[model samples]
Each structure stands twice: as structure tokens, then as C-alpha cells.
Target: MAGDTPRAQPPPPDPDPGGHHPHLLFWRWRRNPLRRRTDRLHAWIALGLLLAVPAVAAAAMLAVGDTAYRHYRSAAEHEARTRDHRAAVLVHDAPRHPEPGSDEAKKARYPVEVRFPGPGGETRTGKTDVEPGLPADSTVLVWVDSAGEITDPPLTAEQIRSRTMGWAILAFLGVAVMGLAAHGITGLVLQRRNLAGWEAAWAVTAPRWCRLP
Candidate 1:
């Protein structure tokens, strides 16, 4: 026995199909004769979850944005209608103003002044820093003869840009979630393949040793 080269042993028989080795169900399913039908089902389940979560998030953001924009625009138009009798005109367009705190600053805009029409068609003027940049020819809802010019709080262009950035972040998160889901599915498939190969190798080696006299 010492001089003889040990014959390589044949592997042990595979575990009974009903035996409870961890991941045994996975092996049975993967190596089942009807692999195509079972594989399709597994593929659909993983792919469906991978797609559905991100799609739902993106749809939610779109719906919220649309509803809010519509409400804001409608309110702006309504305010314009109420000032119709006060001889107000909307500024059609304004030139882009120079950035504040720039070297080329001309006379800085003081509080915007407003004047309204009074009972005898008299006009009064008032001043405040609030001004929605109006074109030189634009007049907004105002009682020009009764009350002084009124300044409306200006909504900065920067604020609008910030709001847009927020929406983009939500969109990016949705995309990231999709990427994670895909990565997880790939990892699961790889682990199962490795496990099956290990089991196959063991099936061959274990039986050979067990059968030794």
C-alpha cells in the first residue's frame, strides 16, 4: 500500500434532492431539466423589481411639479385681473439688469415707488425696495391716482435656478436607485453559479471516498 500510487477516488453520489443543504433549492431549480421555463420566471421577477422602483419615483416628482406650476401661474394671472380698473399695465419685457454689487453699477435702484389714482383722479406715490423688474413702459395693477407706486417683492432669478436644481437631484436619485437594483441582481446570479460549481465538485469527490473499503 505504501509503494502504490493512490488511485484518485470517484466522487460521492449527489445529496438526495430533498436533502436540506443550504441553497439546495437553488441548485435543483437551476439544474432542473425545464431550465428555460424556470429561468424565464426568475429573470422576470428580478427585472421587474429592478425597473418598477425607479419608475414610480420619477412619476411622482413629475406630477407634483406640474400641479404646483399650474397653481402659481393661475394666481399671477388672477392678480392682474383684479387691478384692471386701477389702470395697471404689465411690463411686457425688461432688459436684463446688471448684477448687484458689480463695479459698473449706475444709480442703485432705491425702494421702488408706487402711486395710485385717488377719488378725484389724483395720484399718490410711495417707495419701497420691492420691485419686480418692470420694463420702462410697463405698469402693473395700481390705483395710479389714489395710492403711491407700490413695490412688489422681487423673486430673484437665482431662486428660480435653485428650484430647478432641486428637481434635478430627485431625478438623479431615481437613476441611482435603478443602478443599485441592477447591481444586486448581478451579484445574486454570480453567487448562485459559484455555489453550484462547488456542489458539483463535492458530489464527485465525496462518493469516491465514502465507497472505500
Candidate 2:
């Protein structure tokens, strides 16, 4: 009678005893206190985000550069408004006998120095011969100075124009690129373990026909 009674089939085994679900992976990675390939991928992404430091540095330089240019321009404008008179004097007179070991006497002789007054009783002196061998008239940038003092420095050279924005934009772009690259690298790293495990599991569970191909 026992043999005649049909034997109940054993319950089928689970498809994934290893628990290969995405949610499970996430939970295990978070709470199981074990580092996995997925975790390493995430760490790589974090490192990429850390690259933003270079971008921030670029941004700071942009800000400082703009501020410096503004100050220089202001100084130049003030100087022009107050200039009383400018003269072209050839540098000729050297003390009959240069003071021995005197710092003042050793000062460089500019064939011509442009002397100008500054705001708040300051005196500013700049070399007139900016381009050696060029005519004096071509080298001087004389502005109308009615206030009698140099209020500003010269406009920053044209080379510095738009550089601030360029740097800031470059920083933003760099951060973006770094972030994307890190994310991709992390994904690739994790995929190695995930794919290998998947293949092994498939081999054990699938029919013989699906084994290799």
C-alpha cells in the first residue's frame, strides 16, 4: 500500500538561493557590514566627485582675477583725472660721485620715469620706456588728469580679458567630466563580479542545452 500510494514530489528548490536580487544586493551592501564589488564601484564614483576640488580652485582664481583687474582699472582712471602736467625729461644727471654703498644711489636709472601724484598724497612712478628703442611719445599713455594725482593703475593688458569666465566655465566642465568618468568606471568594476556570479549560477540551474552557448 505504501508503494502503491503516489510519492509526493519534493518541493522545488528556489531559483536563486544565493539571493541575487537587486534590492537584496543593495540591502546587504548597506547593512551586512561587508564590502562588495558594488561598494567599490560607489567608492570610485565618490572619488570622481572629489575631483571637484580642482574645479573649485579654478573658480576662486576667476574671482580674484576679476577683483584685481577692477582695482587696477580704478587706479588708472583716478590718475588720469588728477594729472597736473607731464614732461619728457631725458635721464642724464648721475651724482658727480655716486654715494658709496648707498641704496638710493644704486637705484636703477630709468632714462625717463613718469612721475605722478596719487590719491591721499601718494606719489606713483612708472617707467616711461615700456618698449625699449621705441619713441617716447609711442610709449606714454597720458590721460587728462585734473585732480593732480594718479587715481588708478593702467587698464590690465588685453590678454587678461574674459579669462575669469573662461576659468570658471572650465572648472564646471572639468567637474562634470570627472563625475561621469568616475560613475562609468565604478559601474565597470562592479559588473565584473556581478557577471561572473550570474554566469556561474546560470550554469548550475539551466538545462544542459543552455550550458555553454
Candidate 3:
């Protein structure tokens, strides 16, 4: 009988009777003899920051977006009122070829001389850029400001929306960064305080335990 191989042993039993993993979600808030006041404070602070960060970021984004939209809209309206389109006669033909190796050679539009009535009703001659192949005396429309100086057109609605969204996104990211920074700082401070508290507590308890036996 002793020469026969022994049967395999059974595994150890689980420490927890219910066979459930420890609950972590609100563990800091749960009542426990080992849980400290600092732990509770940390839990509350974490919860508050979790809720506050997105709320603040969203509010800042909306405020900045609205302000940017209004500012751009007002400027567009002003430009519309102060600008005009006028027909001008070309005094000469657009160059068939741009000067070799010149910056104009890379441009899609070519500058040519043109005559138009000024704001004072006097005939004025200035250079305006246009597509190539226009013959002399050809009439073309150009944007002119209140002073009759050639200028760019106003910002389109799409441009305004794009710019507004850009500013809003930047603001949202800025607020989120600040919130993260604040949370990190708070965590460092709390960690130091908790460590100090544990050290002090251990200093008091260690001597008593040492003297017991």
C-alpha cells in the first residue's frame, strides 16, 4: 500500500466567503476603521473636479465662440457698407508672359494698368491684378474702398463660422489644460499631506508596539 502513488491535494479555500471581488467605486467613501479623514477629503475633491472640468470648458468655449462671431459679423457688415465694386477700363494688355525668374512668374494673376473714376470724380490710373489675356479697353470689375482704393472683399459667412469655431476650440483646450493642471497640483498637495500624516501616526504607534512584548 505504501508503494502506491498518493492522491493529488485540494486547493486552498478563498478568504472571502461571498466569493465577490472587492468593490472599488466609492471605496473611499465607505465607512471603514482604517479610512482616514484625508481619504474622504480626497474622494470628494476628485468627484468635484471630475464634474467641474468639462462644465467649465464648455462654458468658456461658448462664451469665446459667441464673442468671436459677433466681432467678425460686425466687421463684415462695416466692410460691406464701406466698400463698392466699380468697372474700370484697361489702359494696356495683360502681359502674355511674366518676366523670367520674377516673383510674378509664380502668380496666377498678372498686374496691368487701368483707369477708373476716383472718389472725387477725377480720372485715376492704378495697377490692378487680373487674369492674363485681357486686351486693351476691356472693362473689368474691381472692389474699391470708400476712398476708391482697390481692396479685398469682405469676409464670407463660411469664413466667419470657421474662425469662430477655431477660437472656440482653442478656448476649450485652454480651460481643459488649466483644469488638469489644477487637479495635478491638488493631488500632489494631498499626497504629501497624507504621507506626513501616516508617518506621524506610525511614529506614535511604533513605540507602543515595541514596548508591548
Candidate 4:
């Protein structure tokens, strides 16, 4: 018997029969007596809300986006009401060909002197931007308020859609940021709670686990 080779011993089983192994990854969900009610609550939160994080964030984004777009549309409509489309005559001749160095050459629009009717039907003159290449006295449709002050042109359908989409994206990003913040805070809270739980558990179990038989 002494000359026989020793048989290979099986690995020791985990001391906590309810837990999977020495490493306690899911010890809270295991059927262990040491697991507290708070442990179950935290476990359920991690499990039940794992998919909900993105879903809630997306829903929040949609709600905020709808509100933002409605406000934007209302403002745009108000602007349209305050502004009128009317023709203004150019007082100075437009360049036949703007120099490449000019902003007009790149943008194809130019600020030039123009005269138009005021609210009182009197001629009013001011420098306003226009599309390039129109000669002097050329009548160009522009947006003007009742005060005869130049204003931004009304939003085209494309412009409205673009603005709506831009605002929606911004809203979506904002919600996503808030969602991420919430997830981070929840993680920190869970981490602290889990650390405290481990400390409490170790206080009771460490002596047994570490004692030499």
C-alpha cells in the first residue's frame, strides 16, 4: 500500500451550499440565509431594470422632443405673422461678378443698400443682405416687419423639418445624459450597499473561513 501511488483527491465543495462557488458573483440571488431583504431588492433592480434604462431614456427623449418641437413651431409661426414678404429696390448696383475673396463669392449673397415702403407708406432705406448679381433698382422679395426693419425670412418646410430634427436630437441627448447619470448614481449606491453587506457578512464568517482546523 505504501508503494501504491496516491489517488487524486476531488476539489472541496463550496462552504455556502446555496452559493455557486468561492467567488460570490450572484450570492445575493442564491438561497443563502445571509442574504438580506435589501440584497433581494438590489438584485431585482439590477435584473428588472437592465433593459429599462435605454427604454426609459428613449421615452423621455421623445416626450421632451415633442415639447421642444411644439414650442419651436409656435415661435416660427409667430415670426411668420410678424414678418411680411415684400419687394425692396436695390439702391446700388450689384457686382457682375463678386471677387473670389468676397463673402458674396463664397455664399452667393451680399449686403447692399435697399429702399422699401415703411408701415407709413414712406420710402425707407437701409443696408440689407440679398442674393448676388442683381443690378441697381432690382426688386427683390425680402422679409420685413411692420416697422420696416429687415427680419429673417420665413422658414421653408425643409427648414422647419431640419430645426425640429435638430431640437429632437438635442432633447434625446439630454435625456440620455440624465439616464446615464441616474445609472451611475444607482451603481455607486449599489456598490456601497454591497460593500457594507460584504463587511457585515465577513464579520460573521471570516473567523470560520480563515481558522486553521
Tens-digit lDDT track for model 4 on 92-209? Answer: 8876554755875767777898998888888888777876677899998778986788888766767777777777777667766775676567756765766676666666765665
Runs in model 1 lying further than 4 Å from the true structure? 1-49, 84-103, 112-114, 118-123, 128-213
Number of the predicted model whose lDDT against the real structure is largest = 3
TM-scores for all predictions:
0.34, 0.32, 0.64, 0.63
Candidate lDDT scores, in order, read: 0.50, 0.49, 0.79, 0.71
Clashing pairs in 4: none
What are the per-residue Cα lDDT tens digits for candidate 1 across 102-161? 544344443444445655567555443323345544564543211333434333345444
Candidate 3 residue-wise lDDT, 1-213, digit = tens: 433333322222223324265765566778877666766786788788879989999999999999999999999999999988888899999876556445665566788889988899888788899867679999988888898888788889999999999999999999989877877787678767767776666666655555533
Error of 3 at 19 (Å): 23
Which portions of model 4 show Cα errors greater than 4 Å?
1-42, 95-107, 196-213
TM-score sort, best first = 3, 4, 1, 2
Best prediction by TM-score: 3
Error of 2 at 198 (Å): 3.0
lDDT of 2 at 204: 55
> Which of candidates 1 and 3 reaches a greater TM-score?
3
Report residue 15 deviation for candidate 1 (angstroms): 27
Arrange candidates by lDDT, highest first: which order? Answer: 3, 4, 1, 2
- Candidate 1 least-lDDT 10 residues: 142-151
Give Cα distance to truth, residue 36, candidate 4, Å.
8.7
Question: Candidate 4 overall Cα lDDT vs. reference?
Answer: 0.71
108: Cα error in model 1, Å: 3.8
- The RMSD of every model to the true structure, in order and in angstroms, is 12.8, 16.5, 12.0, 9.8
